[model samples]
Target: MLESYLQVAEVMFMQVRLKAFIIFCVYTCAKFLVKRKCEFKPFKMLCEFGWILTVLLILKITGITTGDFGTTSVFDGNVQISFNISIENFSIATLLNLILFIPFGFFSAGVLKKLRSKWIYGILIGLIFSLTVEFLQTFIGRFVELEDVLMNTMGAFIGYEIMVLVIKLKDRMKMGALKVE
Candidate 1:
């Protein structure tokens, strides 16, 4: 079972990476040709990829709606009422859901640069994105849990905080350099 889980994870990871690469390439080309900005920034590309992968993984983790759907079938549409406490449930899936949105917030603010200045935009986008995923899951005959939404938003907030810290640190370093000069 663990091996199968790992295999599935590997496949998902590959798919996410491929999609991210395509998006990055398209954006890079557009920026280079349209804006005439051709700076070689490897870290920026990596951050973009990470953000894309994180969003995809979050969707996959939360939206489990692919299956038979009917009143009698197992895919009966439902909304989850209870929260899964990690301490009591001891489930990795729950933990994964909680941490899934961090990259969405972190990479959005960290790499997008525009979003870094307006951090609320990233947080709002993350919330709306997670809400949409949950809403879609409900329509597809899956259980949408409020707990998942809360956890996802919390993860995004954590990521946003991390970005803020990094930015502040970078600014301080620059200030220190100016003083030394």
Candidate 2:
């Protein structure tokens, strides 16, 4: 079972990587063309691209792209919704769901300069994204679990906090270097 799970994960990872590569190529070409017409910071553009990739990866991982959505009715009997909050129910899937959204939060915090200081917005974004993904999963013949939503939100919050901490440390280091000079 573990081997099968790993195989599925590997396949999913490859699919997402291929899609990301294609997106990167197109984004690069677009950026090149747009750069000539407007002035935008490369860092901000990269951060925004990262967030887009993160969202695509999440969709792919959740079987949204690969599932039999065409045949599966949204109200099908197979569409399971679990509100299981028990820690004993934890599995590798739970961990992956949590890890998956970290990039979502990180890129969101990095790209939204005005919301950088507002940690609540990062959490809200995470929550909304997770909620949307779970809702869509019902149509894709995947289980929609409340636990997954909660874990994803927590992961986003953690990612946001890490980005904030990094910025603060960078500012302090710059200040210290200036003082030393």
* Tens digits of per-residue lDDT for model 2, 1-181: 6578668767777667767767866876787898766556676677777877787778887877666665455645677889879899888878877888898898888877766768798789889989998888888777788999999999998888877777778789989999999
Top of the candidates by lDDT: 2
lDDT string, candidate 1, 54-157, tens digits: 77766555545233434432354244445544456645655566576787888877776776777677678678877888767655467766677777777787
TM-score of every candidate relative to the true structure:
0.73, 0.78
Alpha carbon lDDT at 172, candidate 2: 100
After superposition, the stretches of candidate 2 with alpha carbons farther than 4 Å from their true spots are 1-11, 25-46, 70-72, 75-78, 177-181
> What's the TM for model 2?
0.78
TM-score of predicted structure 1: 0.73
Cα lDDT of model 1 overall?
0.70
Q: What is the lDDT of every predicted structure here?
A: 0.70, 0.80
